[model samples]
Target: MEAFFYIVPSLMIAALLSGVWRLMRRSRRVARAWGGGRTAQARCLRSYTTTSGGGDTMVSTTLHHVYEFTTREGRAVRFEEANGPGTTLEGDLVTVHYAAGHPEEATATAPAPGRLLAESGCLLLFLGVAIAFCVLFMVTAHEMFAETDGLMP
Candidate 1:
């Protein structure tokens, strides 16, 4: 029983490590693309929103924006990303970065290594860690109180 309770924090540690790995990978990818890519003028095609988790939990909404740009070789490329120019409407001009031959590998804006949603796993990790700590503390206190109950009587 107590062992089961300790598992929560152990799982949290794993999750935290996973999050750190994801964040590092994400940062590296962004840095690689932006650091070694060419810049082009992109146009906003359309933006859409998705909603989830309605019952028993707060509704979550995510907005996705799509952009179309032409590479140096005149190849047309369209990419969808969760992060892009905010409040930029359709047909608006935006900046994009992409490799010389790989137009599909592109990003609208250069996200800072520490700020990229970096979100990719940080948010989930934080939630997991918080829940795990709560569970651990609760289980520990319960055991302490339970053990002392007999002495009090």
Candidate 2:
């Protein structure tokens, strides 16, 4: 039972760390790709809200914006921005960055340094708290088992 308690939290923390690492890696790749890409004016086509986590948990909503832009080669491409919707409206002109080879993978917004810092800080904070709780639970379980063993025979 004590082993199970320790193993479960350890697994959970490992999984969380893996997910965070993957997200950071993908963000860096996209940022690098956009840095050398060309910029063009894109028009906002529409906006829609996506909702998740409804039952028993706090419902979260994200607004997605679809945009259309024409490349220098006169190719028309439409794609939804990866980030949530901004202050853009229908038919509004926004700046888009796209690589010459992959115009479909365009982005209207670049990752902000401040936002990235905040996200990293939050992840660190959560990791610290989770590790602390796991340690506390393991210590408590060890003490209880020790006391029971001492009482027997």
Candidate 3:
């Protein structure tokens, strides 16, 4: 049906917006934590490979690293980071940035500029297309209703 065109794009736009909102909130949380967090030395306890999407097509894999550190108050904390597995090895020393209030939420690596730029570009492109499709849908609906009104006795 003609309505499919409008419904599909509308759903996609909603999904994209939701994803962007979540990412923004998470980034803000991490940024706030990093700004007020303390620094500590952590050791990479182990590394593992996670695989997804295989079979006859292409397979994707990511390496995850688990690190542990002791807080100033002598509390032990462990965090897993999938961003920089190749950069560290078991027993390797890593610098960790963590908020004192939430030591479990820590990161050993900063977000990559290239990846950030790529994501921004993709989001912008999708937003532009979605807006255009929405306008088209509205115009088509209006025209259809106007024609029907004229046809009725």
lDDT per model vs. reference: 0.73, 0.76, 0.76
- Rank ordering of all candidates by TM-score, starting from the highest: 3, 2, 1
Off by over 4 Å in 1: 110-153
**Candidate numbers, best lDDT first, in rank order:** 2, 3, 1
What digit string (tens of lDDT, one per residue) describes model 3 on residues 15-42? 7688677766656556544664588899
TM-score of each: 0.63, 0.67, 0.71
Candidate 3 clashes between residue pairs 3 or more apart in a chain or in different chains: none
**What lDDT would candidate 2 get against the real structure?**
0.76
Error of 2 at 88 (Å): 1.8
Q: Indicate the worst ten consecutive residues by lDDT in candidate 3.
A: 28-37
Candidate 2 lDDT, 5-83, residue by residue in tens: 6688778778767867776775665565476468899999998788889889999888889999999999999998645
